[model samples]
Target chain A: MPQISQLPEFYVSQIFWMLVFFGLTFLVVGRGMVPRVLSTIADRTTRIAEDLAAAEHARTAAEAEAEAWAETEAAQRARAHDLIASAKHTAALATQANLATATARIDAQVSAAQARITAARDASLGEIEWVAADVAQDIAQRVAGLTISADDARAAVKGAFTHG
Target chain B: MHQFQIEKLFGADWAIAGHSIAFTNSALWMALSTLLLIVFVAGGLQRQVVPGRWQMAVEGFTGFIDGMLAANIGPNGKKYVPYIFSLFMFILFANFIGLVPLGLIGLHPFTFTSHFSATGVLSVMTFLIVLIVGFAKHKLHFFSLFVPHGTPALMVVPIFFIELISFLMRPFSLGLRLFVAMMAGHVLLEVLSSFVISGGNAGPLLFAVAGLPSFVLMVGICALEILVSGIQAYVFVLLTCVYLNDAENLH
Candidate 1:
């Protein structure tokens, strides 16, 4: 039953306030909030990317260090083996040289001892020959009891030797 | 003076305290709208995935809301999905409900007091709720939201005061937009429909002539109203989100 004539005058003011409300809301929403949220998102993404990159770098470096260590250990092992082989070789050569020197010294001493023995044996043989001659001459003189002259003895020895 | 022909759509017996309320048809339409919204949403929810026609409609609404949040609030804006979604759905439901043609029976019951209609009450209530939500979220920053950044010291104090006044005006703007649109549509429809009054001898002929234009206009307006209803609902929610954004971010 409400008539148009009774309509309130507040409608005009209502419309005005509506426009004001819209303007302020738009300002607050668009300029103030959106940019901050967008920036935060960008920052978070960038940080994640940086973290991932750092992790990758660390991984690669560790791998390289491990490879280098393995290579160095391999080279050290080879060098140690070579050192052991070379030491054994030197030891073997020294032992051979020492054995040769010892043998040579023994040979020289044996030669000197053989020379001394030959000399001593000849001196004894000479002494023994002299004694044998003296005995034989004494025995012959006693048995025959003949003391003939020297010249006669000489001539008889020569004559007997020619006849026999 | 010409005698006023009192043409009542309901029988002459239909009255509220010996005066006609014209509420019967409007009430029926309102109830029908509410029922349709519930049925559609419930049926859609039940399907959940692998949606049928009804379910697809609901999913479309949800997906659209998701896209809006992601675009406006960023990918992390998914956090506020439920709040935004509920705001959108409720308004959408209310607007769609307004479109049902229950003749003169569709006016809301609870919103009606001794003086004002329920539709008007709903608009004001919705507006206040949005304002409070914004305030609760931002607190002090909500007040700062109106003042533009990078103002000079001389300009700052005046601008701050103006901003404060403007900030206080939000609920009025939000509620009136919806209320005006709805009230205008309904009043226009009612006036047009009244022209096809059934009077004794001239009823049929008069009804035919007036009914054609009225029906055509009503149909055209109805279609437009459907679109307006949906759009208004979206706008309401969009503004709410914008307010929420201001409060939280302070810019």
Candidate 2:
């Protein structure tokens, strides 16, 4: 049709304009506009990455602080446990010392009571021996109508008492 | 048929350095498309940390191209983004603008892509770039592109000739695909619209009966054309990328 037949006449002009317009579009869009769009995308990605990194850093710091506090608490608890154990040990030692002193005092009181009892028995025995000797001498003089010596009666009484 | 007519808007039959430089409807639309693209892209150059809607749209388009280049051409293809982006934006805008029925307002909406001359130039430019890049990267080895690595020596001559012809046809095929598709779609729309108008002139009753079906079919075709427009643009750029890859990698 005319589009095919008039190619020689129109082709040059079409190509000419095509070059002009196409070249302008290429320069303005490719060189001017595209880079801006690309940069905007790059900026957004960078900001997101930065925010994530900051959050991770904050989390790490918080974890470290918690760990440190836990360590301190553990150390203090161990110290308190040591103090309690030492107090218990000292109380036991003091109770043992007090018990030994009380037992020694009770033993002394018992020995003193036994000594007094022995003294009272010895005095009664002496009195009984003297009475017996007198009685024996009198009986001999009355019944037998003989003069018996006092020393002899006493010896005989003493021997009888010893044998009984 | 009248939609495809090229009329001079300004500048009397002019030429510069023995070259005709008349400003025609085709040139005006091309300029308009370029202007709109500039405004669209430049308007969103806010560099906001969180992009607004306009910025998001612009960035989305850029990312689409970036991903395409990365997938097809690898990292080295990034440098050619400007050229490829320009082609995509120009063709896309030209296609969409052509769909507007400015004739309802007594204004001509000339689609540059419907013209073979325009698409031919574009395809040739792309092919030239491929050649330049191929030679620059591979030097004398670029000629080895026609030679299959594991072919019988006896069949090499015939295969080489076929490969050479295929290689030479790249530009014609690329250009013709876009031009023919665009021209055919617009011509169909023009014909269907004229039919509706002529049917109405017959009588109101006949218009209602005949025009309705034509109108519905035109609407369907319009939707198809829109799809084709987008696909053609994508195909053009995708083929460019593939050619570039071949140039760079020699495959």
Candidate 3:
């Protein structure tokens, strides 16, 4: 074959040119471009990783904030509940105090009214005794001409009323 | 045979000393393949965070060679990426471009990879890298590639000689594998096409029986040739990596 026969003549040029081309390829494309491309990919990967990490950080922060908010809200709720309970307790104590004052006033008014009624009855009883004493004197003088003293008659009436 | 002939282009037969400095058809194709490869790789130089189609293609091939080296040569294989990448791409481009039916357009596509001298130089360069690396790292112990790991004490000498011979044959075998595979495919296609022509002149009967089948075979072989071209380039690189394995890992 000419491939074999022609080789000795063709060798130098082929090798020379092959070296030139292959050398250029190795330098320009292989060494230069390949790394550039891979570095870009590596950059993208790191960027994505950073973004994910930032997102995770944000998520954690939000969760912590929510937890704090919940805690504060619970405290606020408890404070409000305490305020309501204390106000209710104060209102109940005030009501009890007012009821005690009203009850004392009513008891005083009722006892004073009873004292007035007793005094009136005692005054009427005194008047009734005097009337009876005068009436008896009149009856005795008009019907049988017997005279009786007011004092005696008064005493007798007193004794009879007292014993009865 | 004429298809395989190296002819001078540009109307001048120039030489430097005894060496022919004239630009030949082979040189033109080599330059063309380099330019094409550069253009292909230039797309990747955009360096976008997200790769485009051309960038992806370039990166895909780079990653493929990288993966192969990583698999074969272990951690230290990274240093040889540029050389391996260049060799693989150059061979792959030559193979694929050679299969282009440019002859139909009255233009011949010379596949330099089909030349033993071209593949020989490349394989020898690869072998040299191994040798240089092996010696640089291991010094005199680079010779241990011949003894292997598990040779019995009695047969060590014979095994060492045999291994040494086989180890030396690596580059030649590598060059021959690619060169023969490519040359044979091209020759087979040329032969069958000639059959188609000869049969046509003989008779319609022969044309129908022989020319048609020959044409069909040529078509089938054309497809196979494409596959073979890719496989051969891969095989060349794979073997280079394996040889490099001995150098880098010393296994």
Candidate 4:
């Protein structure tokens, strides 16, 4: 084969070029490129880890804030309930006092009105009795030609009202 | 033989001392392979956190080599990643580039690995590294690689010599395997192609008998050639790692 016969002729040239090319290959691939690729991968991993940590931190803070807000809301709710209860109690007391005062005033006014009505009725009855007595005296003098004094006529009328 | 013939690219051979050093077809292919390798390596060096396809492919190869070295040589293998990575990719690219049938387009695809001179240099390089690592790391204990573990005292000496011979043969064996496989495959294709041509020139019956079957076989072998290229590249790197393991670990 020409490969055997021609070995002495070409081996040096082949080896020379090979070493030159492969040596450069090693430099570019190993020295130049690999470190950069590895670094990039490392950077990504770090960034991802940091991002995850931040997310966890934010979540924890949010949970704590929510807890604080709940406590405040609960406290506010209790305070509002207490205020409402006290206000309701005060309103009830005021209403009771107003109702009692109104009832007492109304009672006094009614009693005064009752007293006036009783006095008016008594005055009307007295006038009516006097008018009846005068009528009786005049009738006795005209019909019987009897001389009758006003006092005696009154007494006779009273005796007749009392006897019936 | 014609495929294997080397000619002067400059119409003259460059000689150093008494040896003829010519820029030949083999040198041209070597340069082409290296150029493409640079492009491939450069394409993948985008250095983005999330890699593009080119970068991913580059990572995939590097990762594959890293894993292999880690498996074979273990913890101390980290330092050899670049060298091993280059070796694997160089072989893989050369093997694959050769199998590309550029002949159909009136161009010859030369497999430089098929040349013993080229394969020999690569094997010697791997062998030298193994020697250096073996000596550097384990010192004199690296000599224990010659004898298998658990041998009887009586058989130790003989086993050592035999193992030593095989160990010595490693570089040549490595070179020979690749050179023969690549050279033989190309030669076979050329021979079969010749048959198809002769059959076609003869008559329809001969064409149907020889050309057709040979054509079918060529197609089948073309597929197999693609497979072999990958496998051979894998085997070469695997053996390198194994040899390195012996040197590194003294097993």
Candidate 5:
């Protein structure tokens, strides 16, 4: 085969071209092209890494903001509970004050009614005593036909009423 | 048969001192391959943050070679990425370019790797680099690479000679393997296609019977050649890395 033969005529040109082409390929690809490709790759990687870091930072900030919001919400909730408790305490105190005033007014009305009832009972008893005395005086004069003093009748009636 | 014939393109028989120089089809194909690589590299120069498919493919190839270098030669192998990657792309493109059927246009389909001159240059370059690196790094101790780690005094001389021969044979083996594999595949395809053509001339019925199987086999071989093209390129690079490792670590 022609390939097996080292025919210097064919080999010389082949070698010459091989060196020129291969050397050019090496110089162009190894020196010029490869670095460009590598840099592009490196650039892309760096950009990705930067984007990821930025995303991570944004996520951390968002998490911090969320935590702050939660803390504020908790504080507001506690304040609301405190306000409700204070309002409830004031309402209970006001209800107790109103009840005490109503109770005092009712007790005063009950005491006045009791005083009026006692005054009426004493007045009725005095009237009853006078009537009894008069009757007794008249009856005594008629039955015995004796002249008795008005003062004596009165005194006897009084003593009888007192004993009854 | 006609594909292997070298034709001078335009250069005259110029000789300097004792050397002859002429531009040929082999040079044209090599130049074309280099141009393809240049265009390939140039196309990816834009460096998008979000790369398109072509850019991704280029980067993927680079990463593949990077991974190979790292695996075979360790972290220090990163420095040789350019040389190794260049070798890989050149061989890969040469093999693939060879498969293009340009014979219809009466142009030779140049299978550059099939030529020993091309593969020999590549292999010799690699071997030289390995030698230079070994000697530069290890100096005289580089010779000790031929001596086995555990060997009797009597066995040392013979083993050393064997190792030396094997080491010297690296370039020839590397070059021949690629050349043979590529040449064999192409030759088979050529022969089979010729059979189909001649079978058709004999008789339509014979053509149908013989040409059909030949066509089928041709397609199968074509696929195998494609696979072999990639495998041979990978093997060439892999062996270079192994040689580099041997040089670097003296193992």
Candidate 6:
């Protein structure tokens, strides 16, 4: 083993080189390697955070849009429902008014039919009475043929009408 | 290769050596550090949400790294978790590997060997890179990093020069910290083991006497090794983060 005291000039050069090595290694590792690694880590973290925030914003916006759509859809449905009800109500009222007018016309037509029936029955009854009177006058004329005097004939007719 | 200490150049105890190109015991431990980093990180990354044993261990480490960076820097400082975790793993691995007993410089066949041949070009290269990171982040502010803020303009030149000295000293400090820690830990372990082995030839009474203290110390140092492993790694990363913060947000 070469003691520190006995080490020759070559050993001194080795030490000098070692020191030089130290300076170079630290410079490269510290300046080049470490900074690159650290920056990458920072960049990754920042990118992740930014992506999450953007996703969150998009989600919230989508939710708000969905809510607005739902509201509009509901309003449209309500409008359609109101229109159908109004249409139904108007149709029902129109049908009812039509029925009422038809009923009035039918009533007027039935009353006219009844008046015609009554007038026809009274005309038929008058016709039957006239026929009966004619038949009685003919039978009385045949029986009173023997007496030809105007006063007698008139008296016979009156007597016959009274007996019948 | 000629070795000359900086004490001659700078007239001080803290000196620089030039022309030494061989790997030291510290370099061996540092190379071993990669294995630790790989094992821990690969294990951690492969974890499931509901962790297994390996996953739990990795999770514990990851959580610790996260907590440390967050507390010291800011909650967002978790961005530095992988780097900090890797830094911790390397240091911890280096410390543990350093605990292995060695016969001589670069002679041990095990990865724990501190032999000159074991240290590679790659490990030293990495140290330079870390320092550069501190430099790049600070830029002009890096010069000011050594100089405290609020100093008057008249003091700026002297302070700037001092700051430059300190800034230049970072890599050395970092490298030396790992090297010294590894060297010390291994020496202690080796010495204790030698005592245990030598005592085996003595009488049972003598064997038990030397053996007990050596055994006790070995166990104690082993525990201390674990702590040092974690602490050194933490210190490296802490300083790294502080330097980065200074560079990133200069006063």
Q: Pick the candidate with the highest TM-score.
A: 5
Look at candidate 3 and tell me the lDDT of residue B135: 98
lDDT of 6 by residue, B1-251 (tens): 01111112222243354343445444444444554555554554442434577655655665676667776667546656655655555556655665554435653423222323223332343445545655666565556565687889899889888887876666566656655565566667768877888887777787799977898889998898778766766776777666555554555
What local distance difference test score does each model get? Answer: 0.55, 0.86, 0.88, 0.84, 0.87, 0.58
Count clashes in each candidate, considering only residues at least 3 apart in sequence or on different chains.
11, 0, 0, 0, 0, 39
Question: What lDDT does candidate 3 reach at residue B28?
Answer: 91
- What are the runs in model 5 whose C-alpha is more than 4 Å off? A124-164, B148-155
TM-score winner, 3 or 4: 3
Q: By lDDT, highest first, what's the ranking?
A: 3, 5, 2, 4, 6, 1
Estimate, for each residue in B1-251, the C-alpha lDDT of model 5 and write its tens digit.
76776667876667655666667777789888889987886776667878888888888888888889899889888888889989999999999989988878887788878989889989999999999999999999998999979889999999999999999999999999999999999899989999899999999998999987999999999999999999999999999999998898897
List per-candidate RMSD values in Å. Answer: 16.2, 6.2, 4.3, 4.7, 3.5, 10.7
DockQ numbers for every candidate?
A: 0.01, 0.47, 0.51, 0.42, 0.58, 0.08
Output the better candidate (5/6) by TM-score: 5
Better of 2 and 6 by lDDT: 2
Query: What is candidate 6's lDDT per residue for A6-76, written digit by digit as tens?
Result: 35633554455344544333454434444443444446568789999999999999999999999999999
The prediction achieving the highest lDDT against the true structure is 3
- i-RMS of candidate 5: 1.5
| TM-score, predicted candidate 1 vs. hidden true structure | 0.46
Return the lDDT, model 1, position A144.
80
Which pairs of residues clash in candidate 2, taking residues 3 or more apart in a chain or in different chains?
A: none
Off by over 4 Å in 4: A48-164, B11-13, B70-75, B144-166, B249-251
Candidate 4 residues B1-251, lDDT tens each?
Answer: 78888777863556767676678888888778777888898898887778899988988887788889999999888778888878878877888888887989999888988888888888999999999989998898888888788999999999999999999999999988888888888888888889999999999999999999999999998888888877877888899999998998886
* Candidate 5 similarity to native, TM-score: 0.87
* Candidate 3: clashing pairs of residues: none
Show model 6 residue runs off by greater than 4 Å. Answer: A1-17, A120-164, B1-21, B32-71, B74-89, B96-228, B239-251
TM-score of 2: 0.78
* 5 or 6, greater by lDDT: 5
